[model samples]
Target: MVTKSDTNSVQVEIVPSRFLMPETAQRLLCEIYKNGGIRRIMIHGPNMPREVPYGPGKGIPIEANRNLLVEIGDQAIELRVKVGRIRLEMESEDYLGGLKAACERALPFSFQFRQGKFFHDRMTTSDYAKYGKVEDERILGLIDPKAKKDKLAILSEDMVTFKEDEER
Candidate 1:
């Protein structure tokens, strides 16, 4: 179980000047994942609907053909949003410099990086009603309670990709 002390982890947010495409988002995410101190990550942006939501064309499939999959250390993450901003918690402030560098390498345009309390430190009523006293605090606000599909994906630093890179 996560305690109050553990919830005090350093939180950082990265907001790009514009909404990122899947390819750019994928590159940025892979770099962030490579740096390896991310305890939790949340991406925010406008949702891309799979079908028309209103009008006579409602319920019909949209013609938008976009690759929503991004590979990070052998893990393929599905992109549900346009990736305008990214909020994450780190183990410590020591990793901030490397994170900034990673963002610079991936993002060609300007971006903003700030530090503050962005995530919930404690569980909410909805969370309790849905998950019933979750033991893992890292994912407290990572997903929606009503959503049927689980959006949370866990990636380890000890994955084969990382191990292979270390051997070189």
Candidate 2:
């Protein structure tokens, strides 16, 4: 049985002073991916309504000014939420320095970087019901079970399997 103390992975949460614009989020994500230690990553923020839910403009499409499209490792991903904070699991704390540097270079304003258990440590019944005995712990709790499809994306499998040279 793997207990929390038995786990070697470290989780990180980054909350920027302000919500990140799509371009800034893209740059930050790209830089973090380049570091190659991230096991899982999730973004959080308020959902931008696709249409005016009520009031005078009910059912009308709304332009929220969110880019919605960003590329990481050359893979384009559509972000459904306005990015305010980022939470990620890393193989270890060895890569935290690189992550900090990446943030410094990408973010023009202040942000908070914290280390803690921000993700679910164990799979729940809902996860098993949705994914069916998932073997990859990294993927657990990363997706919305109610959604038709998972939002998870793999930038490059090779990127996580090995550590890149610490040149940067």
Point to the candidate with the largest TM-score.
Answer: 1
The lDDT per prediction is: 0.74, 0.74
Tens-place lDDT per residue, model 2, 30-122, is 998888788777778777766888998898887764347777785666676788999888888899999999999999999999998887858
Root-mean-square deviation of Cα positions for candidate 1 versus the true structure, in angstroms = 6.6
Give the TM-scores of the predictions, in the order they appear.
0.81, 0.78
Cα lDDT tens digits for candidate 1, 1-168 = 844564446889999998998889989999998898877777788877768889999988754624567787776655666789999888788889999999999999999999987877689898787778766565566655555434454323344222111100
Model 1: CA > 4 A from native: 1-8, 145-168
- The C-alpha local distance difference test score for the whole of candidate 2 amounts to 0.74
The 10-residue segment of model 1 with minimum total lDDT is 159-168
